[model samples]
Target: MLGSLVDNVVDMFQASNVDWKKIIIVGAIFDFGFKTVLDVLQYRSQCRASPPAEITKTGLIDQTTFIKSQNYSKSKLRFGMFERTISLFQNIAFLKYNLLPKIWEYSKVTAATYFHGGDIVAGIVTMLIIGAGSTVVGLPLDWYHTFVMEKKFGFNKQTFKLWVVDNIKSWVLALILTPPLLAAILMIINYFGKMFVFYLVLFMLVLNVLAMIIYPTIIAPIFNKYEPLEDGELKTAIENLAASQSFPLGRIYVVDGSTRSTHSNAYFIGLPWYKQIVLYDTLISENTSDEIVAVLSHELGHWKRNHIPFLLASGLLNAGLNFAFLGLFLDNASFFSSLGFNAGDMPTVVALLVFSDALGPLTAILQLVQNLIVRSCEYDADRFSVRLGYGENLKTALVNLNKSNLSSVDADRLYSTFYHSHPILPERLRAINEEMDVKKSAEKKRQ
Candidate 1:
């Protein structure tokens, strides 16, 4: 029977004599060290005298812009490195002193004392405690990053009171929604027992679908205002472009993102048959209508090529694998003992926390592959836009966007591959130009 096989596997794990605590600590250090190396590489690239000749040749990125972009990027990188170091040490110390088990015990006792002794209730309490702790610890860093760092770079638009309100709203939203969601997930895992991975993945898929449905309609409006894009020549052009591509354009909403930051973006969200595109008001304000439509052509390229679905499928696969990986270690008795608990009585919530923290370092190594796929898709989307006769406009829009955003257009190859989801600006421009040349050649041949 299945029980017999599981027992044998458990016995084998017991015999392995793995010191999981030390192993996890070493893994964390190694992962952090690798990332630090990437940071150093990026710093060197950013410190270069100028950007590549290709980017300079376009006469788009002037010396002042290039220097400003490098300085901004380098400053952010340094800030990020500092924050990450703090997080790394905190995690290491948390594990070293065995705080997770203590928190679980406290949550369990509290649940028993007041919540009528339910596992789900205890798990929810445990998560809330952890969330509160994280929020408190991160508050100062968040404040400094927003008020000091971003403001120094001329990006912060919110007043201190507005920032405070935003944080309070986020906390309230999390408090209202998180407990029930966590409890439901715990229940699914408990109900499925050994086959939890299979059921958990399905539950998560359903949850993701529901989130897509509710986020724009319900969740997003809570934080910011969404207004219909006004009737204009721009609107008419966007409609015609979508019609030419047979895109299922439903509604266009411009979100009030300028209240927080000057950065611009555009993305589509909805179910298969009814896609909605949301543009940052900043995007509309900053770009020409032609450029905005051209930028949207690149976005439509993502939909036309099924990139979103591909990413979704890949994400689900990754989640399934992570669940399976967790399953492997769940019955590893030594791991529980190292965390000051026994495998037989280990709380599912506690086990999940331990596994997530300990396994993250190793799991992160897989990110390179995901980044590679994403970068390729960006190139493909650019090419798609080029094929649609938006190549020149897209390039101009991209340049302006990059300049406005102060994006680091040049990057070290290794660091870029390991970190950036999109190709560097110069590389993207080169690819776009090549695609345009190819289109022109094909037209000539046909003629």
Candidate 2:
């Protein structure tokens, strides 16, 4: 009779059960599989034949040599060590408790209890752990990459002091903002449960709007000084063209772009009160005002077409998907509690971090989609520029800029598809020529 009762109890538990041990095993397997695959693919892709000659064909030291001169040994060593440590620890955990089925089963039962209790402090604590860990491990690697390697390549203009100051300021910014935001998100998760997706999507859209409004006026000035375009004929020409196009451009600003790096490009940074077009001094030194105007016109095209709003809408949709995925993990308390999380323990925040880390490949896919839209918008903006003034001038400016920087005219299609935000120079030039031919034909018919 006792043996029969015990067997019945086991059957009942098996019928309605959440096994947490299986989950841990799965996480370990996923981590190992992802890291191995990514590492192998990245190594295979990077190991190309002799460095492209175009990079060094210029009289200056080749970009390849400059890049190689920078010491990445420390970063490589750090990454390898980190990966090994994670793998080792996970293996140890698995070995110590071969009874994943039982532990995981218990973790699921306790998940709800932990969720009920975790609070804001829990979120903040997690943030500090992650922030500090990233700082200690990631910062030095970046320092070596930028200051040591990029400087050797003649790309970095920032002094060590400047770099240190920037890092401190960045950390301060994170400290000020991230904890509260994360805590608030955790609070939201508490009430909404899986329904947190809608709120999260709204929040992302609002954030992007806020950024568009405030960045040029406030956030940008912290990193670089800005002044109105100097009193010159170039300024007059741009203003005149703006008036002709009914472009609501009030001012053009020049930024001290060289303070941080040698790479140069111009961009429009904000909305309305903060709406300003910024030109890089490097651009000023390289191109005529006519060419600069053509560039500015392209930026204006983005604004005129409401591309920013479109981007924001797309971003919100993407955020919705992310929060939905997060909801799946958050609803199951066992999933997180197993990973050292608790309910009153800020489970949402902790779970979020882990979910985000797990979702890296998905994030990459979304980024690729965003880049595709941006590249398409760029071509439209280029067409707008040609309609407003000079396509040839823009092309000339592009050619000079590409040659000066040793920009890769051609790229491996797969690489460009994966990594490039903008289309390659050859593609851009070809598009411009096609537009110009259409324009010329239109003008002849009108005559």
Candidate 3:
């Protein structure tokens, strides 16, 4: 049975003809150029908008703060351009030289000599080596962004020691988790043949669920401290809001977000039974209790509207499609050979990298669609918060959050459509105000 399958796979490869080299080069150029143009256009748009002379209805910043924010945005744009330029050159060089296959060749030989297993073991070792190499190469950029840029903006709180420790912990965790997962994938392919796509999708679904469950409990605590939210009016307000909304109330915990950066955020972790709401300590210090409750109300709105499940379903659909295409390419030995790999000599990890690159354009289009959905969801959630009679408070929270995070309040429509997963600060504020006005008008009529 295995022999017949192998023969069939080889035959399929022999009959196939695809210009992988041309496809990769075109995709790389298109993605690089498109993103670079968008970045420049967005930056220009921000620069053209003058800071309000006084604080406006949208909570426009004072001139000093506005100037600082502009500078911060410019610095980030410059850094992103530098990073992307480096990445584009790196990717082109890697593809042109077929470095992945070379790395795989070296890894397989080393694995056979030192390790006591088959292709799966060697593939895992190869993937780890590649991952480690990439991480080391990118470390300087990450360090500069964290210690230099963020520090200059007064957002960074991470010491060099903490940064190093965090990276090491991340590496250790990846090592512990990745090999088994990769092995399972390889085993599925070996056993399931064409049906591997279906099984792989199943594996990914299971992995996603497990990650959601594990992240807040086992993984997150490795980096930051999490303590139950103190007995306070904030906690009482949050509980009351959740109760009023019929939202599942969970144990509220505060994360030491200021340990790494002054940027504030709030999110929930775990499924229904084991859920917890995590508020950044920075957020607590920066905003009022009502604003905090308003933010939580927005989050609860996501749950109430079933956005999570919808997102998950969308992701699963994408995964299924991706896995199906990947299985086809992996089985096609000619595809590997065209990229300087020997026919039938491709590793699973290498195949994944190549396949993802080949599908880059398609993936980008899908991402744009996903962003539209996400932005719509954001609007819906904002309306939900307003319906809870916290529209003004939520608006205040959004303004403060944007200011604290140094986020640009406005961007070009095209840029926002392509990149933003939520409406810009001004748009969100307008929506909230409109909702509030409608509510007030209805109340006056009733009176």
Candidate 4:
């Protein structure tokens, strides 16, 4: 069956005279449109469903807040649909007009004239130009989403100046970092031929590790102020929790997340030896000390369960698979020709985009699998908090977090399957409540 499907796809490609650019653009639109329509339908269906009796019975939020959350969800969904539709049309226009190839050619010629090196330097320069241009083009939509949509919902906490600064910082960072990475990958491809894929995977692995190490100390501080959690009962409780779990807790810092949005979150960052915990200032303000401790316990649970290393290993595996497919595409002349590029003259940058597009369906499958893994890990982490006797507190924190963020606590199951990294609030609350019941029953039996 699989072989027949592959043969059919190949036959279809062989029959079509469409340039690879057109094929990719059309395929992208179809793929995105299909997913977007399905998601919107799901959103609409959820909205139409009678509000769950559990929602009101649980008393997580008042009716007003519940209505507000539903409106927020629908508004975001409608906005997303609009954004994606516009993007799809823009992409079609861009490809149909051959703007990408034109830009690529222009960048190549300019870089060659100015740079003393060979194609590698020119390739890097072209990529940088293309990258910067893409970022610039997307900025307006980003501004609207951040400033207009979020502001309407009372979530925007950023000034226009801060937004501009962030954009500038992002572009500057990309300019500084991306060129060398592209240069190295191109050099490897030139030097090692097919083995370039394996080496590229290793390069990515090392780069990710370096990012993890530098992110907390270097990159993050550029965005938000991070102050060490001051001497207080909350600090002491967190320390005690870590000590009890035999977890090597590093410095705890509170980030000024309120500077950007009202969202509350907690995360663990840095290497094991230099591990740090960061709590959003909004989380600190919104939640009690016990609830905060409960949240940290869940985070520590991820560490205790080796979820970080597990995710890293999974990422490396995914990279290996991607590069393997990339190697196959690079070796196939027909693949390049199908995409409207002469096989003989295909640039590394162009080939990279084609390789990625070719593997889109496979990437989607892999992402779905990864999401399932992530959701399972979240459940395990929740259980870990329960084991630490913070189950009730964690449940309370989850409820409050969902309420404050205006997140729909219950989502369409199918939608959750595709999109949610963590279980919906109701599912999590059910699990915690069940665990508490079991614990209580055991205590009663002992008495």
The C-alpha stretches of model 4 lying farther than 4 A from their native spots are: 1-22, 49-54, 441-447
Global lDDT of model 4: 0.79
Can you rank all candidates by lDDT, best first?
1, 3, 4, 2
How many pairs of residues in model 3 come into backbone collision?
0
Model 4 TM-score on a 0 to 1 scale:
0.91
Predicted candidate 1 versus true structure: per-residue lDDT over 155-261, tens digit per residue? 88888998998999999999999888888888887788789998888888898899889999998998889999999998999999999989999999999988998
Q: Residues 286-332, candidate 4, lDDT per residue (tens digit)?
A: 99999999999999999999998898888788778777666655545
TM-score-best of 3 and 4: 3
Best TM-score among the predictions, by candidate number: 1
Per-residue accuracy of model 3 over 306-336 as CA lDDT, tens digit each: 8888888888877787776677677666677
Which has the greatest lDDT? 1
Residue 132, candidate 4: Cα error in Å is 2.5
Q: In lDDT terms, how accurate is model 2?
A: 0.66
**Per-model TM values vs. the true structure:** 0.95, 0.75, 0.93, 0.91
Q: Model 4, poorest ten-residue lDDT window?
A: 9-18
In order, how many clashes per candidate? 0, 12, 0, 1
State the lDDT of candidate 2 residue by residue for 1-447, as single tens digits.
997986664454334245444544565566556555554444443345433443334334444543442223223434664655664464446434532233333434444356442345645654665567657866766787677756765678998899888888888878888866776677777767656788777767677777777677777887788989988888998788767767677668989888887667888776544466788988888888888888878877887888877877877787787776576556555554454443433255545755654455676688779789878988898888787657978777776666545454545555566667787666887788789899999999999
Worst 10 residues of 3 by lDDT: 51-60
